[model samples]
Target: MAIIFEEKQNIFHLQANDTSYVMQIIRDGYLSHLYWGRKINQYNHSNKLQFVDRAFSGNPYPSIDRTFSLDTLPQEYPGYGNTDYRNPAYQLQLDNGTTVTDLRYKSHVIYKGKPALEGLPAVYAEDKNEAETLEITLEDQIADISVLLTYTVYEQRNVITRTAKIINTGSASVDLKRALSVNIDFRDADFDFLHLPGAWGRERHIERQPLRSGIQSVESRRGASSHQHNPFVALLRKGTNEDNGEVFGLNLVYSGNFLAQAEVDQFNNTRVSLGINPFDFNWKLNPGESFQCPEAVMVYSHEGLGGMSRTFHDLYRTRLCRGTFRDKERPILINNWEATYFDFNADKIEQIAKAGKELGIELFVLDDGWFGKRDDDTSSLGDWFVDKGKLPSGLEDLVNRVRNMDMEFGLWFEPEMISVNSDLYRKHPDWCLHVPNRTRSESRNQLVLDFSRKDVCDEMIKMVSDILASCPITYVKWDMNRHMTEIGSAILPPDQQRETAHRYMLGLYRVMDEITAAFPHVLFESCSGGGGRFDPGILYYMPQTWTSDNTDAISRLKIQYGTSLVYPISSMGSHVSDIPNHQVHRYTSLDIRGDAAMSGNLGYELDLSKLTEKEKEVVKKQVSTYKEIRKLIQFGDFYRLISPFENNEAAWAFINKDKDEAIVFYFRLLSEANSPFESFKVKGLDPLKSYKVENTNDIYGGDELEFVGLSVPTELNGDFQSHVWRLKALK
Candidate 1:
């Protein structure tokens, strides 16, 4: 069993693969966090957890002398307004307006299976033996609020998924102001904070800094898990690296506005919390009403950042993400966005598709501008029907033509957005999210649909569903171009205005659920102007995310690397686009772009028809090579050979599940005058076997290569140069 209860000590020992999390329900009815780290044979922290009265911090139970002071002790689920100053895990506002909750342990149940959140996306237990979940119910009688904290421990993944269910059990109503899904208090803050922060074009840049004494967090208030900040944060010991050291990581499985924070209190205790952002969020829970928070996946690694990352990769890749496309090999697709932008019509699209088909591309996707007089980003976002003017025969004919060319077809849609000049908007202007008197701020010449309203979401879902059902569309690239601005919903009352952002996300998720469920055979790829919505929440619906808007090989190194810190490479939608790169306008070798793109679900975003015979040959070779190694790149264990953050050249290795094959990609970003041939050791190799490099006749023992290292091509010397080395082992 993954979860074990020692009733005598009131300690619950939750084991997830190589890690163990211990917590205790104390004599005073407080559930205190005991320990979370590498597995131990037994837990003996109950005696050491005695709490004392602190000078400034107040206690929760004054009558229970010094058994445990909520102010000083670590907790499993710390509530707000009980005098504990650290950022709270849960908070409630009563009808009389007292925003206090004194929650105590009520009861708990341990089960073999994990329960699904009411209406949210979460990681599930694929098999009963894979994990066990424990539900700890805490309540405050006077406030009549009960918070159910659930912990699911994966036996082989070293991961713990946490969530909370807040219910108003009394006759009176209460407003939930800050109901974070997960929080864990560490005894000390002896770690560094690692986060991904960047702007629109450069999303998910790895940023690591020392944990200061105050609060350090990554959040998004733009009504999304914004491009500026991702919903992932990690704390590792000072010297932790990709391969070594203890690291604790948390990722919120939510796509909307969220907050992931770690606050080191004066006492040096660090409390890490994650969930829907409380900034512009509030939920009113009437009697018998409950609010289910999104799940927070927590992973603990004694083997360093890579271990932590792989744990997440394993769990999320198989359990968290659902759909027919989850583990299957994705199509080698060519999208027309970068190839033709918004100028493409049926003829232009067919030209590109024919070229891609000749080069063995499996799919051709008609990107933006195929619908509703959409020549540019300025108008016609919500109109899902094909533009008869562009495709004279309509979408069905184009889809059939692509299929006849032996290629699958995909289309893009920005269903969450509406143009001010669009027919949908002209008829129902108020349907767009806005305040009666506030200026309706527009982004990309479009307004965000008030998805928080069920009517609006239903319409969009119907439109999207109808379009997908109309044709044999194999994939969908669902894009949300803008973020919330007005912070108001036309159908929401004044007091419920704060609920707009999260409710909008909820509605958006509902639409996704409806569409994805209905189209079980279709593959969905979530995109928010590229990678803005690349989060676990969206990953639940769409297995892969467009890693970034910038497909430049040089820029993608950093973006994909940082994204890999939390997401598996398979989940990244990386493509080889034309040069000078679309976003950066920096010319890169076509082969180098292919090498970088091969690290993800490889595809192309260039005009294949424009390629010279030589360039076409190179792309053909790239596609064939990708097909040869796609299995290794997609499902194999990933190891970071070198970080782009600290080097002029980047390197990484992908080893197959059986350790029989390994592919190493080396990218040279700069030319150095006297730099010796780059040589580096590798990982995840069987020491006893002899492996042969495919390109060269060189053969070496696995240990010799993994320890002494594989050498780069010393003869190659140029900026933006790259080489792919695949090793086949002989038993």
Candidate 2:
């Protein structure tokens, strides 16, 4: 069993394969965090919770002991206003208008397997032996509320998932002011705060800072988990690097507004909290009503950030993400967004599809401007019907033409948005999210649809379902171009107006659940103006996401590398787009672009017919080479040898599950004159094996390549140069 409970000491120990998390119900019923790190064979009842009577740290339970104060104790889930002044895991406003809450440990249950969250995305236990769960109930008798804190430990993974369920057990209604998923108190603040933060085109750029004496956080108030900040944060020990030292990471499995923060108190104790953002948010829990927070995943790695990343990749790729495509090799698709954009006819699209087919592309995706009377981003967003002006005959005809070339067909849809000029918006102006009489702000020339309404969600499901059922669509590129603005639902009550954003996410998940389930054969790839909503919640429904809109090879080195910190390679929709790149407008070689793109699900987003014969031949070989290693690239274990953020040269490797075949990609942004000989140690290779490099006479023992180093090709020249080395274990 992964979980063990000691009744005498009131301690709960969650032991994963390589890590352990220990906590206990201490004096006054407060659950104190004992330890979290490398697996401890036996905790030996180590009590790290110390009591210090500081000047202002109030002692809530002075009758038992005057020095016992929550402010100084390491806590699991803490509440504010009652001695502990730190950020709370949850807070409730009672009927009497008091905001203080005192929760005492009631009881706990240990069981096999994990239970799914009521209406949220979470990691699951596929088999009973895969995980164990513990539920600790804490009750606030005065408020008549109970918070059920659940912890699930994956038996073979160094991961622990946490969630909280707040139930209003009294007859009176309770207003939940804040409900965070999980919280942990560290003994010291000596760590570096690592987060993925960036804007639209440049998503998930890793940034790390040393912990100071205040709050360091990454939050999204933009409704969708905006491109500004991902729902993940990590803490690295002082001297930790990519390969060694301790790292603790947390990720929220939610797509809506969320908060992940680390607060270093004046006493130097660090409190980490993650869950739904309490900003502009409130939930009214009536008697017998319960509110469930989204799940927060915790990864403890003594092997540093790389070790932390691999654990998340393994757990999320196999457990958190669901559907048929989760384990399957994604097809090499060619999207026409960059190729034609809002200017394309059926004949033009067919030409591009034919050109791609001749070069070994397996799927052809027709991007925007195919629905409603849409000519540009300004109109007909909610209209899901095909535009006869663009298709001439309808979606079915175009789909048939693509399928005729022995290629799959994919279509793009932005179902959660509406244009003021759209027919649907004309019929129902209140359909878009807005505050009464407030100017409905527009982004990308569109407004976010009020998905909080069942009417809106039903219409979206119907419209999207009709299109999929009408055509032989094999894939879908679901896109949302705008974030929420004036985010008030016309149908919700005034008191519940603050619930608009979260409700919208719930409504979207419901719609996606229904539509994707109905069209089980369709391979769905979620996009929020490209990588805006690329989070675990969306990945639960759609297995993959468009990594970014900026397909520039050099720019993508950082984007892709940072993304690999939490997401699996199979979940990144990377493509070789036209250069001068559409977003950055910086020209890079075709070879480097392909090299950058091949690290994920390979695709192309350019007008293939416009390529020269030489470029076409190069693209054909890129496609063929990608096909030969698609499975290895998508399913293999990923290793980040060198960070693009740290060096001008970036390198990464992928080794198959059998540890026999390996592929390494090295890229340089700019050629350095007389650069010193470059070699870097690789990882995850069997030391006993001798491997031969493909297309060369070079052979070396795996130990030499992994320990001594793998050399960069000295002959390569010019800026944005790249090389791919394929190694095969020799008998």
Candidate 3:
């Protein structure tokens, strides 16, 4: 059984494939964390961690028994008023202006299937037996609040998902200060802190440091998951790398401001927490109301960091992302963003569409200039109407023309943004989020819509859905170009002003849920400038996102590499752009650009008609090659053969489900005259089988590929050089 409750010992044993997690109810109804890591069946509940009394610390229930203390125990859900100083998972502020909460385990129930979070996005079990869940309810009797800690174990994916739901049943309203999704306690600080942090251009770079005394945390306060800190953190043993050592990964399925923290206690024990950032957050839970926190996934890998990453990959790709395109091949698309920018008309778009059709492109996306008078970034954002000046016949006519050219059509919409000069803004200025009389900051000449209001969100859904229904558009690029500023909503009270950003996200999810349900066949891709909103929360609605605006091949090697640490390659929207590459202006060969872009959802973001005949031929070959290997790239098990963060050469490989075929992609940034040749070895293959290289019919045993290594040509000493090798195993 994936979930086993040892009733005799009052212990809960949760197993997810190769991992096991155990917790038990101790003296005075205090729930304590026992063991997590590896698959073990035995857990001596009586032999718990020693609880020592300490000064200025929370004493365990029944003050007479001075031996047990909450401050020294490894509690699963410690509260603030309990006197436990090591960061409480939640805090309650009563209506009388008192901040105190003491919660104890009330009851728990084991179930066969997972339960859905009321108003949140979570990983669901497609089948009844694929996962099991345990719901432990804790109550603060004095505060009249109940917290449900949910744990879901996937039987075959080595994944454990957790969520928290807080119910307010008191007479007066209560304010929830902190309600973290997951809080875990480790026995000792024998690990390192691993996080992904960077700025606007360079995002999600890998960083590892020693576990210090104070708290180490990663957070985003920009009303987004932000380009700064991704909502993921891992604890790794010293010297742990991709191939070896124990690692524990925790990821929050949320896209707003989030916090992931770790603190080493006085006794060297580590307590890590992840969920909504409580800095500028306060949710008002009135009587008979409940607040559901976002889901956080936990994965343990004894094999190494690679195993940890692969576990996240499998669960997110197959279980979290939904819709028709979840398991299907994404169409090869060409966007006119870099080609014309804001200077293109319907005729220019039609010209590009015709050219792309000739080059065998599957889709043509009209990026930003077709709607309103959006010739520049300054005006007409909320007006979703198509400008007849750009396309005299309107949007449906262009969609029909693109369909006539034997290609699917896609349109872009920034529904969450409003322009001061637009018709919608002129009519309903208060609809945008802002503080009264406070100067609202704008990025790219736009303000964020107050999605906290249902009327505004509903209007957006109607406008976009009507356009999609009337046109033959099969894809929608939903975008939010700026972050929220002066985030006070006009409709919310001053006391609830801090809840605007989170409410906006909830409204956005509701809008997406309705529209995607209405147009089930359409593929939706989310974007924020580019990769700003690329997080698991948004991935629930859209299967893919634009990875970045920096299409430079050299820069992409790192951006895409870092994104793949938690996100799957399929979710990244990458494309080959024209050189003197737009963002960095670094020139590279056409094949090199395609090789880098093909690592993601294959696409082109340049004008096909203006390309030289040779470049067009190169594109034709690139599209064909992607179609040939996309099955393996999209659904295969990926292994990082070389780390871009650690090595100069970026290399990775993928193998099919049955392991009969494999392909390796390698890139060389620059070559030196005297550097020695380096050979790369492959992993996760049948060693006894004989494999044949596709380009050359030479055969070798799989053992040679793993042990003796695959020969890479070291003589191609040039800038931006790359290679792609394919192998098939003979049965």
In model 3, which regions exceed 4 Å deviation? Answer: 45-47, 60-63
Cα-based RMSD of the predictions, in order? 1.4, 1.0, 1.4
lDDT of 2 by residue, 46-160 (tens): 6556666686788876675668778888888899898898888899999999999988899999988899986678888889778999999999898899999999998899999
- Which 10 consecutive positions of candidate 2 have the poorest summed lDDT? 45-54
Output the TM-score of candidate 3. 0.98
TM agreement with the true structure for every prediction: 0.98, 0.99, 0.98
Pairs with backbone N, CA or C atoms under 3 Å apart (clashes), candidate 3: none
Best by TM-score: 2
Clashes of each: 0, 0, 0
User: Who wins the lDDT comparison?
Assistant: 2
lDDT tens per residue, model 3, 1-731: 88888878778899988998999887767788998888886777544677566766656555586666777788787887565778988887998888888777899887777787665778888987999889999888988999989999999977999998899978889998888999998879999999988776677788999999879999988888988889999999988888888899999998899999999998898999999999889999999999999999999998788899889888888888998999999989999989999998788999999989998889999999788899899999999988889889898888888999999999999988999989999999999989999998888999999999999999999988888888888998988888778988999998899899899889988998899889989989998878888888888889999888888887888888888878887898889999898788899999889999998888899989899999999999999999999878877888888877887789888888788898888888887778887888888777898888887978878788888888778666788889988889997
Question: Residue 658 deviation, candidate 1, in Å?
Answer: 0.5
Model 2 residue pairs with clashes: none
lDDT for residue 49 in candidate 2, whole number 0-100: 61
